[model samples]
Target: MLDQKFATLPKLILQIVQMLQNQSPSDSLNEIIRLVARKFVGLGVLEVADELEIQEAILRLEKEIIDLEATINSASDIKLAYAHNSKLEASGKIVFTGQGAYMCQVSAGGDVLAEKKDSIFRGGRLIVTGNAVLNELGSPMATPTMVEFVFGRRILVNRVYPGVSFRVGRQLFKVQEGLQDVRVAVDEQGILRVDYLYKEHLQ
Candidate 1:
């Protein structure tokens, strides 16, 4: 069980800080440790008197977060720019208006906009705080693109192709087929589920 949790620790760390900007990196790291403890307990790993093993495990997780700190800190709390058009990689409140298909891997501190009608995110994601306006998300195949919004709990799409999924607060929604001018949200309940969103999801 300890090994299982250790193996999943890296993935958990990635999700914890993915697009989660505007906060101090140190604070985020601290939060990661706390979350790790809770995850262990939830996963049926009881509290052990062998605190050394846990400390070592947490130290390893800290190094993982440190490596990710550059990418996390690259984004600003406010609107930021995309580094390259080819990769379509950007973060921090971006407005992208492009054409054709591309691996649009975006991370934002707040909102994101895919302005043009031809802007397509073939196999990527739009992770943000509030809303994200996109022309297209996901491919006709594969695992589909992901749109994760927590604050506004809304995602507007001009043309949402098949194979798209969303993670709004603690709730999860997926688009198996296509749709046009779509608006996805978790309703009013998203804000009230503070336990799952903050404590559980963050856990």
Candidate 2:
């Protein structure tokens, strides 16, 4: 039964078992003493104590599997976050246009030394192209230029409820999730409309 349980254990646990199995015979014997105490609970009569100990070991192994699963999930989330930040493929350039804006161009390059009015570029995001120099603030309602971050990086604003925000505009947007739907919009209200609709889709 122990052998079967060991075989079904998670890969990490299996590696641990193999490590123990390869230990010196003296080491294995000493460790087995503890295993017996914890895993042999089910044996009846004269061996009842040994059986109960084995049962306890089996319980521990099960718990280890559960713990391993949780760890894997956490690793997955971290990996996803990293993918969103670095190693992300930049698709195309999004140009920002506003009143008195012209000949402004933004590219997929993380770093582009471009100038525009009311626009600020940072962290190698969307390229802004049009008339006039890019200013940090184009319109309060819309991002003059921005990138769609695949993974939303959270910032703690309020310690109580874990208030978080992402970077946006000239500054960080401080969104709970990453940015979404980054496009250049024409007209005043149109930019705001684009941001609102795109943000919803991102969620």
Candidate 3:
């Protein structure tokens, strides 16, 4: 019975061959021929499907590989260092804070530096030279929020909102809308100067 059913396959093949011969040269015509050949000649359906599935799997895997590479490139390294190191003893302002109980690691650029754990923090200030990031050693529950605090000489101003008034020290300053440029500076005394840290230091 199966043989009889398949006996007409030759006729079908002949029809397909004729169709291929008369077909116009187009992208779709080539795909139709491939489909007809695979279906009519008892061609390996499993192999064809497997090849397609493998191709799809390979594409997905390649996408995943690319995503992983991007993540690695953007990831930060956690290293351990001392707060009293000469490298951090320059003249800059600390812009972050962490819970003192846990070991703190500073993330500068892409490298991580582990610093000693301290509980008693006199103030949330790390005066050093250049732009650097400092954090608690452990994976803390929250990202360190940059708050306006008195370090030594320099003043840090964050949370700049448009159409709002800011209270720094004892005076209040009103901010105007559509302000494109902002300048911060420090004077001989503890005052907010007009300047900006446009670029980061290369460390």
Q: Which number leads on TM-score?
A: 1
For residues 30-50, what per-residue lDDT tens digits would candidate 2 score against the true structure?
Answer: 454456444442442235345
CA displacement after TM-score superposition, residue 37 of candidate 2 (Å)? 13
In order of lDDT, best first, we have 1, 3, 2
lDDT of 1 by residue, 104-184 (tens): 566666677766677766666667775677776665564477777775556776666656777865666666555666777
TM-score of 1: 0.48
TM-score of each: 0.48, 0.28, 0.24
User: TM-score of model 2 relative to the true fold?
Assistant: 0.28
Winner on TM-score (1 vs 3): 1
Q: How far does residue 141 in candidate 1 sit from its true spot (Å)? A: 3.2
Every model's Cα RMSD, please? 17.2, 16.3, 20.4
What does candidate 3's lDDT look like per residue over 1-203, in tens digits? Answer: 43353354445445445444534434543554455456434643334444444344334434434544454445333322223212322122222223332222222332121133332112222222222222321122222222122223232232222332323355444433312223433356756443433422212
lDDT (Cα atoms) of all candidates against the true structure? 0.60, 0.32, 0.33
